[model samples]
Target chain A: DQQVKQNSPSLSVQEGRISILNCDYTNSMFDYFLWYKKYPAEGPTFLISISSIKDKNEDGRFTVFLNKSAKHLSLHIVPSQPGDSAVYFCAARRTSGSRLTFGEGTQLTVNP
Target chain B: DTAVSQTPKYLVTQMGNDKSIKCEQNLGHDTMYWYKQDSKKFLKIMFSYNNKELIINETVPNRFSPKSPDKAHLNLHINSLELGDSAVYFCASSQVRDITDTQYFGPGTRLTVL
Candidate 1:
């Protein structure tokens, strides 16, 4: 079963615009959420993360908002750049921090 | 320097063959993990080793095994490989500081079983 889901398979946004990618989870036991950026022929790199205690987390031009009531989360990249065009994966950590469940990635294309 | 590295970036072998993939991390992290990405681009965790000890072993078949000789190295071995096992395998590591530590991933190893 897919506990985490990224409904949008692909997203296109103009450069310098705001790009919002959405994710939904069915499990309430997940306390930690993370976003990773992946490029072609390369491994995914950790981008940003949010804890259950906080509703939002921001790093540089990237921001993540979590809605515990709705079991939803989103990653927003303001002033999105062409370099940010890649696959974005939403991951969740259950009670066991050692293991993580990942969602099917969303391919984002930032047109310059 | 590459914090995490995996050898034989691409491997193509016949069914029933035995092969191994080596992974190493120079970041001095205590935890290492192995993940597989399928054709549909779904990434799933396979196994994890912390400080050279097996910590998490997913519902993978016994034909697949992970070996960690030290804290900085974790390797995956598959015996009697099947066509369904063809996928991209990634090696990752994270520090044991906070429960939400960030994981660093290495360039994935693509294995094609024919």
Candidate 2:
């Protein structure tokens, strides 16, 4: 069963525009949500994360918003740059677990 | 210096063969993990080790085993590999054995079984 889902397989946006990526999860036991960026032939790197206690978290040009009621979360990058283009994976960790369950990644392409 | 490194970036082997992938981290992290990225592009945790002790095994097949000789190294050995076992394996490490900590990952080892 896929506890986490990224409905959009790929998203394209022009440079300097705002890019939004969405993720949904069915597991309410998750204590935190995380986003990772991965390039071709490279391992994924941590981008940002939001705790279940908080509704939003921001770092630099990236912001993550979580809606507990909707069981959904989103990552927004303002003034998107080509360098920010990569496959984004949304992951969740249960309150009592140390492993991360990941969703099928979404490929975000920022066209220059 | 590489925070986490995996050897044999790409491996091609026949079914029934056995192979091993070595991973080492220089970040001084106490927790280490192995993740497999399948064809569907979902990263799944295979095993987790902390302080040279096996902490978590995600019901991976018995054919796949993880060995941590020391705090900074974790190796995965697969016996009688099957075609379905082909996937990209990634090694990661964190300061503490918690999901809240940031995990640094290696480039990954792409294994292909025929």
Among these predicted structures, which one has the highest lDDT? 1
Clashes of each: 0, 0
lDDT for position B24 in model 1: 98
In the range A1-112, model 1's lDDT, one tens digit per residue, is 9999999999999999999999999999999999999999999999999999999999999999999999999999999999999999999996543678899999999999
TM-score of chain B of 1: 0.98
**What's each prediction's TM-score?**
0.98, 0.96
True contacts kept of 1: 0.62
> What is the iRMS for every candidate structure?
1.6, 2.5
Model 2 regions more than 4 Å off: A95-97, B97-99
RMSD of each: 0.9, 1.3
lDDT of 2 by residue, B1-114 (tens): 888999999999999999999999999998899999999898999999989999889988999999999999999999999999999999998887454777789999999999
| Pairs in steric clash, model 2 | none
What lDDT does candidate 2 reach at residue A31?
79
Model-by-model DockQ, in order: 0.69, 0.60
Task: Tell me, by DockQ, which candidate is best.
Answer: 1
**Per-residue lDDT of B50 in model 2:** 85
